[model samples]
Target: MCHSQDRTPSEVGRDLVQWFLENQRDLPWRRDYSPYGVWVSEIMLQQTQVAAVVPYYLRWMKRFPDVPSLAAATEDEVLLYWEGLGYYSRARNLLKAARLVMERFGGRVPDTEADLRVLPGVGPYTASAILSLAYNRDVPVVDGNVERVAARLLDLDVSAKSPEGRREVLRAATQWLVPGKARFYNQALMELGAVICTPAHPKCLACPVAARCLALRHGTVENRPVRSPRPRWEELRVAIGVLRENGKIYIQKRPEGGLFAGLWEFPGGKALEAETPRVALVREMEEELGVRVKIVDKIGVVRHAYTRFRVTLHAYRCVPDPPGQIVRPRACAAWKWVRPSELDLFAFPAANRRLIQALRKAADAGS
Candidate 1:
């Protein structure tokens, strides 16, 4: 609604930074201020909450503390560490970037913004964060929390993801970013939004820069940072064939460079609007595995949600029609038959993990 930085930048920056120095949380990343730790923490924090990221961040640092250590890890092990975090592509890209850092940057996280931008997962925001927080570069960073603080401070109304909104927020941030004080200023601004200036029911009284917030003065704090609504979660129906023979279960690795890339999953696909899920299972097996399968029985259903889709997986127990056929993978990377007890060794999607758990429970009940 309203616009302008009515308060002095020096005054506001001092108050925010002072408050931060006293109240900032003792996060693991902040404990050392290492470039590697900052980069990993920033990537993990995207689309994830601080509380959820803490334990995962801790475990990840313990296992792969530096660029060289991470570069040496297998993709499967990286995915395993990232299992429940969701948006697994982040983890994949992070590992890719780590290897690149070793080969291209001499096993050191790049310091220049341009060099950081060339990495797989490092974008403008992430680059700025690493530069400012890790290298003590005098560059201002704009993440969700920082954007929120800027929006309320300047009463910005456009979507933060949009170009115009970004420009406006950056303008406000630069104004308040004290020279050579980027590390403390940026973190302080974000901390203010994360704690006192939250989207819902902001604690205006406790905010360090409350006197300077245009939205608070204009009585529009709740509606200051406008964001476009997320796309509706479309319901996606899928079928998976869990082929079992001689106490071994069949699983296939997904082709690389797509969703769930390189992860092991049962072969199956979506049903045509006119066909049943079982019908889809037979077709998928023939197409993906190059074998005709008879759907012997329904296994179970598992529901999982991604960023844009809510998937309902219908699993089936299937057997090759001819009892034995040459195994071939037409649409997948590889195929293998493992004992049911060995399923836990492979990294699977959350939905497939649920199916595995159910099957394990059934075997336990029968035994």
Candidate 2:
């Protein structure tokens, strides 16, 4: 890779800013430029595609609109808005942060990176982004897109997944940051990476800073930003018990602070190596809900993939052994017996959503 330091960072920054002003996408977040909007958009954009987040962002803005509204919302309501977004913890943290901002910051999103970092789930990248974009602070952001751009622009040969590699990329981004033009500069760099300097096939012909890109000069843009190997996904078999009594289905809320936090789902758990789906359902019900269940029949299997693992959910229709014994939640946060028609009122995981649809279809056929 070539490191021709002929052009100054200021010159490169100016060119990128000019390019951004002309070619940037007309996103809804860009229209408002409010701190709340930027914070929500950045959170949603993490580990998700821009196209996927747009409608969600719009609906969320319409619903919550600002810090106080979000802070005042119940966890269930917040999770409802975030349904199908997959990562439930993001919504939980956003709610927590909103409440903290209301209590500590007087309902205003913090302006400085340090102040913003105190909020739950607000890391360096998010804090820097909110600061730079919303407050117009002269800070640099090094998200995946910006990291890729930096790797090619400076021809950094380090694997961005490594600690040293990440630090180097951040340093390069900071070094090239245009003071007083941070909002445009940061967005421009990220936009360039997203559209032009993409990972798979970068459009070098359209890149404004292509003239200054070291990876382009060295003909290694395709492989400039190296990544470490990702861990293999673990497969697990789960048994979900669809407990029904007097026309209401039993559902429980997941505990806060983990994957799918605070979302509603049918009671179930991973099957032990020696246990069948029915056996697992019996054990899971007794342990999780403190109630014995008699599995009536198999409902069907549903497969779902999470970020770290894949699960094959074996669902079964079950009845309380004692026939209307009080269903108590021993492991989860809460439990409810809701009419099947009321399932849509609660937010459930994607896998559970599929299960609900299947359950409804089965009920319809039986009726």
Candidate 3:
């Protein structure tokens, strides 16, 4: 109900920076503080939790240490390193942007906001994060955590993702950051939100800026960082086939620029309302691979969600018919036949990975 004009920006900034320096988590990206590290970490962190990103980051940095290394790698190999991290497009874009960095920016992560924004998948928040965190620019990075912190501290009247709300947060950040301390200041604000000023059950007592938070003073801490209503989940029934011949499974690399673009997936499609999953798998196999398959057994089912749709995937173990077992690939960028144990050579979507686990489990049990 009350606006956030009571506390001075400098006072809050001093407390946040001091607290963050002493409390920031020991993350891999923080250890090196290189622009390449910051860029990779920021992109990997998108729509993914920090805990989940750590291992992936470690592996990625090991494999592709610099922009040139990343640029040299093939897209499939890049996605292989980024397999479990959902949002396949992030991996794809990272590869594209890495090549662009090599071609356009002379193998350096762009320092200016404009140049950074032009990279594939680099948006306002990402650009700001790179500039401030890597280049020490006096720019603000207002991600979800920072938005939540700013909304509570500044008592934003609109949703944090809204344009006006972002402007309000940037205005507050511009006034608060100390000279030559943009990196620490931005990290502190985000770290505070991550650990102390959490979305639910915030530790107001532990928060260094608790005394200055207008939302806390007004008893609106729980409802401060208002967000728009999330879109309804669209339910889908998907059927995928783990078609095997001579002990190796068949998988397809999807063509560029569609749902799950360029990622590997088992052959199959949506099940009609009246048809069972087996029927759908058989139909898809005949249609896509130019062969008829016999549904040998049920492998497993996986549930996955994208931004707007949730899918219950049914995975079936299938083998081509004895006589007409010739495979002719269709509607795919590429196709591969590899042993189940050798599946790590290619990248697959989340559901397919789960299917692989179930496949292994079944094989183990059978043996």
Candidate 4:
């Protein structure tokens, strides 16, 4: 941990920007340097893959279109758009930030990282990215990709899981910043880390900054950076897929406080001991939907991964002998009987998205 003040943040910023101008990848967010676009993309990118995010981003931008639109939207609406993306908290935060922008900043996004940090869910990396990219401020954006790149490039043996370790990595990355070209430099470093200096196999030879990389030169690109122990695995038994009536889906809105909040989901909960998944679905639907459903057929099973747990989603196609009127549970705000054609308007979980396709296929096949 050397704090050589000799390497000014501005000088390093300039070099990185020069590298960025020639190497930066063309991403949608890069098309326009606006805080609204940056804010949306950064929030969407949280814990989500770029490939998965592309369609969502496009659809989201089309729907909201601007900061004022997002700010004016309801929580349920925001969650609907962000459905299937997981981590509903990010959607909640986006709304909060948008409202703050409207109220505190005259509906205009802030330009400084400090002011941006005060908004909900805008942490150090997001703040830096918004400031540097949208405002051309000289700040280092150290995301997971940037962290991996920096740690391996410098061959630093620090625990990435710890606060102090993260701070050191951020400091090191900022030391390499290229001043006036903050946006390009930050995006370039991110792209290089994402495409070339990957976790499993790094194409060191193809890396532009390989000559200055201590890890590449010393043959420690793969094994240089060490992290804390892997995340603990937890198992979740989730009951899903609320099938009701003829060719209609029954969905319950999630509470606005926890994971999957505000999103529409099939009414089912965790299966208990001595309780089969089907039985659990029956009980949960009754509890959550105020309707009793008899398990007609098991659609299929789905395996989904969350940030903290692995879920085994048991999807079943059930029918109510005498359909009870759709009602919202205490945890839910509303219920909807959405036709298959209009399923796109409602937010669903990722795994359940595939399940819906399967259901449609089953219906088409007269199953």
Best by TM-score: 3
- TM-scores for candidates 1 onward, in order: 0.92, 0.92, 0.96, 0.89
Number of backbone collisions per candidate: 0, 0, 0, 7
Which tens-of-lDDT digit does each residue in 20-110 have in candidate 1?
Answer: 9999988999988999999999999999889999999999999998999999999989988887787888999999999999999999999
- In model 1, where do residues sit more than 4 Å from their true spots? none
- Scored by lDDT, model 2 comes in at 0.89
Cα shift from native, residue 102, model 1 (Å): 1.9
| lDDT of every model, 2 decimals | 0.88, 0.89, 0.87, 0.78
**Residue 304, candidate 2: how far off, in angstroms?**
2.2
1 or 3, greater by TM-score: 3
Across 1-367, the per-residue lDDT of candidate 3 in tens digits comes to 3285676777778878899899999999998689989999999998888999999999999999999999999988998999989888888999899999999999988898889989999998899899899888887777788889989988786887787887788788888887788899999988988888888899999999887788888888888898789989999998998888877888899999987788889999999999998898889888998989888888778998888999999988888886447799889999988888788788888888888888778779989
Q: Write the per-residue lDDT of candidate 2 for residues 1-367, one digit (tens) a residue.
A: 3264578878888899999999999999999789999999999999889999999999999999999999999999999999988888889899999999999999999998788999988998999999999988999988888888888887877787578778777777787789999999999999998999888888999999888888889888888887668899999999998899898889988887666878999999999999998899999999888889998889899998888899999999999988978777887888888998999999999999999899889879999
Whichever of 1 and 4 has more TM-score, that candidate is 1
For model 3, what is the alpha-carbon lDDT of residue 53?
97
Prediction 3 TM-score vs. true: 0.96
| Candidate 4 lDDT score relative to the true structure | 0.78
